[model samples]
Target: MVTGVEMRQIDRYTIEEIGLTEELLMENAGQAFVNHIISLLDKKKARIAVLIGVGNNGGDGFVISRSLLEKGYHVDVWLVPPVSKVKGTARYHMDIYLKLGYQVNSFETISATGLSQIFMSYTHIIDALLGTGYNGPLRSPYREIIEEVNRSHGNILSVDIPSGLSADGNVDEPILAVKATHTITFQCPKLSSFLFPFREYLGELTIVDIGIPKRAIDQISSERFIWTEEDIIQTLPVRKPSSHKGSHGKGLIIAGSQAMTGAPILTAKACHRLGAGLVTLATPETAHQAIASQLIEATFHLCPSENGEIATLNLSNEVLDNRYDAIAVGPGLGRSTKGDFIDTLLTSFNKPLIIDADGLYYLKNFLPSLQMRKGVTVLTPHVGEFAYLMNEPIEKIEKNRFQFSKQFAEKYGVYLVLKGPYTIVTTPRGKQFINTTGNASLAKGGSGDVLTGMVLALIMQQRDVQSAISNAVFLHGKAADYLTRNGWSPISVIASDLVTIMPHVLEQYQYS
Candidate 1:
């Protein structure tokens, strides 16, 4: 989960301090890639074309070409640059590869059509033309070669990163990048592989350890991380045999309007499904009859209504006064002209509070109050909502999401879960986590509501509050991932389906 810059630092530290030579690391990287892709290689018919640049990535291609040649696989080393341009450690590897009696052909001599035909003849195209250092628009032979590689029918394997793709997660011209079928990145994943637009270029990403020591990686400071299954497994709260319904935690979900009763229903369903002990939904009295029979397991506290939306929060009410472990507001709760109750909830609720959907719309006006809250306030905002919250445009926030998310979380003293293709959970202290689970399947109405409920449940259950927040964000996406993998189409996966699929995913992890 290291960025391109952080990875370079680790590589430099490994070479200088850890005593691992550049040549050794390059060889290890090549071998690790070969080991991972060996099963895909067909010695009987495979014609491998290794597209080499003049960088460390090209050094990796030289090792890969030699390794494939020794393994009895037919490999052609195609040099994008002249022999004189290859220098330093990459040139050293090139000399070894040439000394082994394998001649390298320069692509500069080949026509565009000929290059495409040659690439089509190969079964696999090894893309080592560019690495993480590349950004902006492509130029000359590298751009032309990458374009041909993408047009080719061969399965492309990019070394470290797809050629022309930026490793720093900044996608300026993603169209110029090589579309790889499989990218065997060294050590850990590059930040760009997880981002949109650039992510489409990376087919199946595999992180191969290239002998960079854990100590070397640890010495490099990084705030960004990707949550894996192991992280979710370790963070999940356990239900003891002696525990009862009340032992887990109590959660209050104040959501829904007459027109959008399904929002709170979906939220409560997800909350209860995630093992919340006693779940309560407080909505306007007008909407109570609609959702009352829909959720029998949960209790309802009717609130004052104005135009079918909850108009006010009575502080003396038993439901609000209850020592609930967690309280979640705003899922289908309509826009509020008067956010006095929102201000009251912010000041009074001295526990973990999750605000989502219309709640965010209301909370945006009271941003200053969020800083004064005694309880941990979690705001889940999609790009549009976040734009409104920041009083900025969506385009501005999308360009630098990490910076904006961190800044907002730090400024407001609250956890910020910026939801999208890959949800980003940032703490008040600036620690950020990228949830690796989930996909485009989560792009639907009511999905945010379901996530809000899950966050409420996990926040109350897990002892480590931050881990609980991250777990909720990860699992919410995992449920969508599970549904899509198990016969449900991304288009057909409604928000309620996520609530239904979540139990199986949670139980699978819990029992396993």
Candidate 2:
């Protein structure tokens, strides 16, 4: 959750306020890095290369190189800077490494041809050339060295972060970055690992507890965070042994025009799979038979429509009298003329309302009343819909997603689930929960409908809006992650495929 600046602040506080020695932390990092390397690759006479910088990152490298040599493994230490440039604890470690007769080559003195030759001799390479402090364009030998490292056929292990990656995820575009096979970070997860372009550089992220006191981390007031498995597991709804279907939750879905009937079908099915006790489909009369055929378990309500689409978004009095636990509107409802109908429904519906797809399109006209609305409103908007709602350019919104999403959620008094990589889930009070699960697989159509249904189902079961919605987002992504982990290509997967496999994923969380 911490930015690069915040991470530096925490590090300083750990060393100064907590009185933890920097030398000890550096040793811990190198030792842990070496330990992980031994576990990952066979160490019986294995060869490894440690690429070092002039700073503490290189200090960690020197310790690692010496440790590997002591363990009887052939170790090659390549320092990018001259030996004179190495200062403090890094110089201290380099001195010991030289005294032990380990060769430390100056990367500045090597040619591109020499780098390629040296790189080929090692099967494993430790990228300790740069840590979180790296940003902007590559300079001098670091550039050519990284090129050779990438070109070489060796498994890469990055220390803290890949050499060219920024800890803040500030790259305007993807550039030359070390494509690490695994990155072992210290203390907590960094911002770069969770962000889009930078995330690609981090292959398999491993956060090691480098003994930074929890009190030091607590000083960081960064409210943003990526939800973990424990956070999701703790928020999952517990089913009681004695509870009946009626006690689980009741949900009503107002979606699916005759032409776009797949949206409501996906949403309703997702709701049932997500543990909705009772679900009723309130689609256009013309779309009822098709939706009903695929959804036999759900009851149906054929609402008034003209030309296979709903004429208005108003709810019928009979449906309102039934008092459903939750209601989600606007997934594939097609185009509809909005007047006072949305206002009437928002006031009268009087339950948890999840607006997605076409609903987001409709809600764009009523942004003023969103703050004054009586019921809880959850808006699941993609970049385009959110841009329409805010009347901002797509480019501008994407660049400042966190800031824009937080403002909209707080100003409108609604829970905004802006769907994207590490989807930002922000509450009206400015609590941000970044979802880390899922991938590009969920980018297909009908995915939002499934997520909307999951949120609606959870809201019906749980009273805490943040907990319900956050868990829904996490579970929705977990389903996609589950599919991808099982060899289903993200590109080949469909929304229905997510719904089909989601129950099995949910089953894993049952007894947790």
Candidate 3:
């Protein structure tokens, strides 16, 4: 998704380079909106109110009002901020409204009591009062109009975006904005549609073709990337019938503590579930019984322990001799981890090293030398853990998720999966993927462990590291989404539930 600033650049390039006139584009946009809205409503009986502002957004409203009136929809036009202020292309459309015998009212003409009644009279409200350039709480009439639109029983359709939403919609904080039931955006989705708080306002987003050249959009390199299921289908590892256990990767997951043994077991099980040829859990000797009986298909390497925590010093030469394809560490691991052990793992395990959870905590002190490590490292950290790694405040990291994730991944020379609502999977080669799947359901305790295992399995199976990571993250969220759709509440869907639902998600995604 393009930010408001980047979208403006693409629009400028389209209009200037491609020679598409602004008036013509607005006309096309208005026509496209009218067509979509007609499909959503019965034209003959539909009573529509077009709330227009003084800018190009208002121009689109004027064109919409004219088109709807011509299509036999009962259309009322509200030329907000005074109709006299509407000028240029906007005024041109309003002039046609007057010439064609349609009425247009303004804030100056309509009384507050009458305004409420007029708004309530319409079955649908079209918000054209603001555009992508708008920021924060709207001033005066715009805010008042939006609040009334919200109060009304009308199904609101916003033009371009819900007016008053900050162009930087991806910010964590919530803002007062117009709540659009459906938004028919031109060209591409705006950044607000991708961000939090304000993202909730843009309900049922649809991108309408507005004649902008695709080549123009391809120029945006603001570290913004989107991954789809088709991307997963094309990139996921192909398992041949002739492939043996030796062909698929053997992943070693060193995790779990006495109290947190579930995390390691979850990771190990998820790895095996996702087609890992063999998954070995290297945990403290005491926690072996927990996973050994539950997940009997996997092998276990019991290490010396004290009070249920693994003695990193007791790691044997036999583990190094195993020559696993991928190794993941850190989930459910207590603070007993030593730097020498991490260094040994870094130096010994030359394949993909996925560090998550407590692994990030253990690796914090070794941050300076992370890039100098010998393997393909992947660090998966939630915002808090990520903030600690950067030695910055959590607020700062949360506010700049994409930038911070990208900088950290590039600086540390590791693929960073900054997990959150829209997970940021940043590759060392400067590519940032904004994952669009999953929901609040995946925000449980053992979710990260499940993700780590899924990533480890994909890395072992697929040689293309970035693609494997991206597909794993996507499928992880899709699993949560599957449970949410099939009778489970987001609150009830546990991390292990995601693991339970993975096969179903994968089968459905592959078939559907």
The best candidate by lDDT is: 1
List the pairs of residues colliding in candidate 3.
Answer: 169-192, 170-195, 330-359
Per-residue alpha-carbon lDDT of candidate 2 for residues 1-512, written as tens digits (9 for 90 to 100): 66778888888898999999888888888888778778876767467888999788889899889888898887788788888899998888888889988897777667788889999988889999987777779988788888898998888989888888888777777578899999988777877787666787888988887788888888964677777788777888888889999987888888888898889989999998888999988888888888888888888877778779876644675667475877888898886555345555676776778888888787777777777877788999998899999999987777667788989988988899999888989988887888988888998998999999889888888868888899999989988999999999999989998889987888888766
Query: Between which residue pairs do clashes occur in model 1?
Result: none
Best-performing candidate as measured by TM-score:
1
- Tens digit per residue, CA lDDT, model 3, 201-248: 988888898887778888753656788887988888777979999888
Q: What does the lDDT read for residue 277 in candidate 2?
A: 96
| Number of the candidate with higher lDDT, 1 or 3 | 1
Tens-digit lDDT string for candidate 1 (230-347) = 8888879989999999887899998999888999999999999888999988899999999887889888888898889998765453446475878999998897447577888887
Candidate 2 TM-score, C-alpha based: 0.92
Which run of 10 residues does model 3 get worst, by summed lDDT? 166-175
Give Cα distance to truth, residue 198, candidate 3, Å. 1.6
Q: What is the descending TM-score order?
A: 1, 3, 2
Candidate 3: list runs displaced more than 4 Å: 92-101, 170-174, 313-322
lDDT of 2 at 395: 74
